[model samples]
Target: MLDRLAHSRGLPQVIRTDYGKEFCGRAMVVWAHVRGVQLRLIQPGKPSQNVYVESFNSRLRDEYLNEHWFPTLLNARTEIERWRREYNEDRPKKAIGGMTRAAYA
Candidate 1:
């Protein structure tokens, strides 16, 4: 998934994540090292350290995930991607002066 995103949008300088096994494992470490991307791990049990991601996750759960049931993994991916696009590109955010995230960017 990260590979696909990197191919489409280019690599980020750093990735901030929790100390999950998926992110902390050797393969992920190697991948980031090869790409010159820094992996910044938040403190254990400290979701507040990653406020932006936590907020996004909360909104995703409340506004999208909780409202839909997927019959398949692909369906879930597709629907989530659709919602993600709308959330980032179409939905206006008052915090950003009532502009969509893409437009604000």
Candidate 2:
């Protein structure tokens, strides 16, 4: 997902994320190093540094997850894929001057 975001906007010089396994795994570090994309890790138990994504999670949940229910994993995946598209393309965001995510991109 970070790669997708970076590619869409152009290669970012750096990225900040938590110390969770997904972000701290060897593979992820290797990939970031190879790409010259600095990975800034927030200290464990300190969340204020990652407030951007933490805040976005609330919005994502409210606008997408809260609006739908799924009977199966496949169904959920499909709906999420479609919802993500619309959210990225049409949903307005305050972070980007109140423009849709794609528009801001």
Candidate 3:
């Protein structure tokens, strides 16, 4: 996923993530090291430090995951991707003056 993001939008100098096992693991460490990307792990118990991701996760669970059941992993992925595109590209956000993120960008 990071690779795809880098390919599409270019690499970020720093990645801010929570102290999840997936982000803290050796592979993630090595991947960051190889790319010269700094990994900024938020302090434990401080979800406020990563409010955007936390909010997104909450919306994903409530609006999509909780409402749908998928018989296959591919179906789940497809639906989630659809939701993500709509959220990021189509949905208007009041924070951005009621413009979609894609339009704002």
Candidate 4:
């Protein structure tokens, strides 16, 4: 996921995530350190620390994942990309003064 983001939009200066295995792996730690990306890890069991991401993940799961049944990895990636584009470009977010995320950015 970070690789894809870096490829498309350049690497983020900081990465914020819970201390999940995927985020805490040695490979990811090394990758971030090498790229000078700071990792902000939330305390275990504290979803409030990363409320924005938690909220976004909730909406993505409810609106997209629950509605799709991808039969393959490629199909899943394609569908997820479509949903991501819509979420970032088409949908207006209340938190951003009713602007689409792309516009807000």
Candidate 5:
């Protein structure tokens, strides 16, 4: 994913997420720092403060995982890639004033 992000059309300035142990680890922190990407991690146990991502996660699970069970990590990755494109380019978002996130972006 880091490779994907680095090669993204336009580099993003800030990325916000929940401070799970995986992201809170020194490795991730250092990686973000080295890449000059700002990582905005919400306080643990305060999910409402990160409502957008939380809701996104819920919707992602509902829209994809609940419908199809992957047999392996590779299948899951493929499913995720498919959904991510639709989510960004097609799905309308309230935060973007009802425009698709891709349109807003």
Candidate 6:
């Protein structure tokens, strides 16, 4: 997911994340090092530090996950990708003066 974002939108200077195994693995550490990106890990048990992502995730679960039933992994991926595109391209965001996320970007 990070790789896809970097490819599509360019690399971010800094990545802030919690200490999830996926983010803390050796492969991710090496990848970040190779890309010259800074990875800032929030202190354990500090959900406030990653509030933005947490909030987005809550919204995703409420609006998408709880509402859909996927029969297979591939179908789930397809549906989630479609939801992602719609969220990024059409959903209006309050932070950006009610513009769609794509327009804000």
Per the 3 Å backbone cut-off, how many clashing residue pairs does candidate 5 have? 0
Candidate with more favorable, higher TM-score: 1 or 2: 1
Candidate 1's displacement at residue 67, Å, is: 2.1
Worst 10 residues of 4 by lDDT: 1-10
Give the TM-score comparing model 3 with the true structure, all chains together: 0.90
Under the 3 Å rule for N, CA and C atoms, how many clashes does model 2 have?
0
For residues 35-72, write the lDDT of model 1, one tens digit per residue: 99999999998999999899889999999999999999
For model 6, residues 1-105, the per-residue Cα lDDT tens digits are 779989999998999999999999999999999999999999999989999898878888999999999999999999998988887799898889999977877
Candidate 4 lDDT (Cα, whole model)?
A: 0.92
What TM-score do all the candidates reach, one by one? Answer: 0.87, 0.63, 0.90, 0.84, 0.71, 0.78
Q: Give me the runs in candidate 5 sitting further than 4 Å from their true place.
A: 92-105
**34 Cα displacement, candidate 3 (Å):** 0.8
Task: Quote the positional error of residue 99 for candidate 6 in Å.
Answer: 4.1
Model 3 alpha-carbon drift over 4 Å, by segment: none
Per-residue alpha-carbon lDDT of model 5 for 1-105, expressed as tens digits? 764867885556777778777877898788888878799988878999888778879989898889998899998999899998998899888877999976787
Q: Give the top-scoring candidate (TM-score).
A: 3
Q: Which residue ranges in model 2 land beyond 4 Å of their true spot?
A: 1-6, 71-78, 81-105
Order of the predicted models by TM-score, top scorer first: 3, 1, 4, 6, 5, 2
Lowest-scoring 10 consecutive residues by lDDT in candidate 5? 3-12
Clashes within 3 Å, all models in order: 0, 0, 0, 0, 0, 0
Q: State the TM-score for model 6.
A: 0.78
lDDT of candidate 2 vs native? Answer: 0.85
Please give the RMSD to the true structure for each candidate, in Å: 1.5, 3.7, 1.4, 1.9, 2.8, 2.2
Could you give me the TM-score of model 5 versus the true structure? Answer: 0.71
Which of candidates 4 and 5 reaches a greater TM-score? 4
